[model samples]
Target: MYYKGVYHLFYQYNPKGAVWGNIVWGHSVSKDLINWKELQPALYPSKPFDKYGCWSGSATIVPGQGPVILYTGVVDKRSNEVQCIAIPANTSDPFLTKWVKPNRLNPIVTADHNMNGSVFRDPTTAWLGKDRLWRILVGSKHDDTGLAYLYRSKDFVKWTRAKHPIHSAKTTGMWECPDFYPVPLQGKNGLDASMIGDSVKHVLKNSLDMTRYEYYTVGTYIQNKDKYIPDNTSEDGWGGLRYDYGNFYASKSFFDPSKNRRIIWGWANESDTKEDDVKKGWAGIQADVEVTFSFSSLDKAEAFDPNWVNAEDLCAQKGSKVQGGLGPFGLLTLASKKLEEYTPVFFRVFKASNKHVILMCSDAKRLLSNN
Candidate 1:
């Protein structure tokens, strides 16, 4: 998160070993988002609340209280998951290098006897409400149902679980790393977590532990009712739209107040064998950033159909002659250099009744090699 003049990043790490066991939050700071300097572990197992391990959570900046971190902690050897909080040891430190968990308020929220303690983890960033209460969510599951449990606080310390979950889905298994925030309905700018109005919409994204894919829905937050109702544009179940079609999970997004945009971070699982992982001494937990480029094989194929064209010439068009309205625009690939065989892989955005629908497709037909 960008705070003060420095960008602070807190991530799950194992200080005692290279592998996933001895969990703690490794802290790092940067002036520019690129180059970073590592600081001491921001959070680790110390008290009874997080004695076993320290896990994922989020940071929130309060108006006059500075930044507070809400994280899931393994309370005992049984691996009971509980929500906990940490405060900066010195808010004056520009990097906010040190943090301390108050014992009195440690393990601020514990699972009820009827709730499954093992699956509860990953609290989202907290947001203030119209009722002057601070609210947050913790991911959990109950007998094949994924849940985002809601908890509210008056002072960001003591938390009380709501009568019902903020949201849930049956047969989806556990929901991990749940994220909730508001976005401008018509603009690209991001809204603060607490922002609510007719011009704004809320998005709730959850990483499905069973499928290892992140699913999100654009919805409305009925503040008075404390419920989220997703628009009909997307499904809110296991078969819903995903953040990525492949290996990405436990995603987190934060609004960049500085840039007026939202930034997302996710972990990508390694497809390689375990033998290869131990040899490398690490697993694939990484930031996700991708880019794609398209080119035609034929130099003069400007028809924009399944015609062959050189990639260079197509890119040279610079979108000058391209018509734009939720484009399925992209280059036709696997085409013969003579402008013969090709396939189009593109994305189209459609205006739905309540939201925009994006569809990606690749057209491959039986084309004789001779052609």
Candidate 2:
């Protein structure tokens, strides 16, 4: 009944022959949020508003309506303000054929009065508390304070402005599309921000929270600004927006009403990641995760050492109780993934963190290769 089902993904892609990238949104179809099939583009950038690119954005299912889209329509560098574009989901072939044009209500947002009008873009949409109102987290001010500009809307189309910007150092430095919503405690990382993110620890009872992964991208927004500080912050108290480690960005999440989940994924490609561009082969890859979140007693759950099991040793931990998990846990490296199914492939940090391993069991895969 949901056409493409509960979720669909659209990312910035540069097809066969275009400028290095001309802003065509490559799409993928998914029903279970697990397996995904790469489909042709769903949207293309040609019009005056988004002539340069149809950058990152969010998709909202409109119940009796349709998929009300809210995305950044990035124009040329001369005036690169991201415009808002909306579209209905059931409009195209979706396999590699025609693309859908946005509706008449284009440019729901243009430049912001608060930040540098030019850098203010990448709209992350979500419910603004219980007001039934909506909010867009626009990353702005690359010229000086780089911050996530907060703009609220009563109807998805109309807009309002927040009293303050997320001026915290954590939220500054060229903050791109920011996805925000309250989530429950994930696991335990002491009092650190990881406390909530560490929530994937207990029984695999699915909740509307990160049973596994979710994150945002960041750089120094603007030499840090006092205005960006949260209201609750005291001079000494620790408070500021936190980066999702490194190596993630331009991310936005959709609030799924049907499933009661706020699922998200990032481009996984950043200007900073330019180093790995050559080594990884693919210019960009989607974050290998589907996330849900909660906001209750998050620490009550027992955490699992997701990275504890090496990809090759997945079978070994089949029945083993998990110790504190680590990523790329023990030989779960890319080298081990060449053959067949990799087990216990619960979480991948992508970059080598504490948890990265690829210990092989049979060596049969390697034995033949060595021959």
Taking the tens digit of each residue's C-alpha lDDT, what string does model 2 give over 1-371?
Answer: 12444457677777753224566777777777778788778777777778767776665544355556666776676757765765654455433234455556677777755456566666654433344555556666544344566676676776766666644232224555555444434432212111112232211100011111222222221111212222222221112222232344455555454555545465444443544654554575554533543335323233445554233344344322244232222322234446443222333222233433322222212221333
Provide the global lDDT of candidate 2 against the true structure: 0.47
Q: Write the per-residue lDDT of candidate 1 for residues 35-142, one digit (tens) a residue.
A: 989999999899989988889999999999999999999987777999999999999899888899999998899999999899999999999998999999999999
lDDT of candidate 2 at residue 337, scale 0 to 100: 45
> Which parts of model 1 are misplaced by more than 4 Å?
285-371
Number of clashing residue pairs in every model?
8, 37
TM-score of each: 0.80, 0.57
* Model 1, residue pairs in steric clash: 295-311, 296-309, 296-310, 296-311, 297-309, 297-310, 298-309, 298-310
> Candidate 1, residue 284: CA error in Å?
2.0
Q: Candidate 2: minimum summed lDDT over ten consecutive residues — where?
A: 202-211
Error of 1 at 139 (Å): 0.9
| lDDT agreement with native, every candidate | 0.80, 0.47
Residue 349 lDDT in candidate 1: 45
